[model samples]
Target: MALTSHLETLKKKHRDMSEAIDVAQRAPGIDGLRLADMKKQKLRLKEEINRLSN
Candidate 1:
């Protein structure tokens, strides 16, 4: 796959994860640890997208 495609995919993944986290945060009895993990994953995806774009 092309670099641009990879970047787009990463961005989409990050957005999807963010939305998921938001939903999870709003739900009752949500796990804080899982939300933290999702945030970490989002950060890592963003870093990867930045690296690939450069």
Candidate 2:
């Protein structure tokens, strides 16, 4: 049950990261570098989720 909840949280973070990237794209003033950092964080979260599932 804990694993299931963790997986769900990771999925939600992934979705939020995706939306953030999209928003960054649409905005001219936002720092692209910051968006890239968020994407990296999202990647790490996915990797952790995979490790936990295994």
Candidate 3:
């Protein structure tokens, strides 16, 4: 049950990060490094979710 809850939270965070990246891309003068970092974090979350799922 706890693992399921953790997975849900990670999924929510991944979704939010994707939205944030989209908004940041639209905004002016977004930091390139920060955006890259956010994408990396999102990828890590996805990997973890996949690992836990199996």
Per-model tally of clashing residue pairs: 0, 0, 0
Q: Which candidate is the best by TM-score?
A: 3
Q: What is the alpha-carbon lDDT of model 1 when measured against the actual structure?
A: 0.91
Q: Sort every candidate by TM-score, greatest first.
A: 3, 1, 2
lDDT of 2 by residue, 23-43 (tens): 887898888789889889889
**What's the lDDT of the predicted structure labeled candidate 2?**
0.87
Global lDDT of each candidate: 0.91, 0.87, 0.96
Q: Which ten residues in a row have the lowest lDDT in candidate 3?
A: 18-27
Whichever of 2 and 3 has more TM-score, that candidate is: 3
lDDT of 1 by residue, 4-46 (tens): 7878889999999999999999999998899899999999998
Q: Tens-digit lDDT track for model 3 on 1-54?
A: 999999999999999999999999998999999999999999999999999999
Every model: Cα RMSD to truth: 1.1, 1.2, 0.5
- The true-versus-predicted C-alpha distance at residue 47 of model 2, in Å, is 1.1
Q: For each candidate, what TM-score against the reference?
A: 0.90, 0.82, 0.95
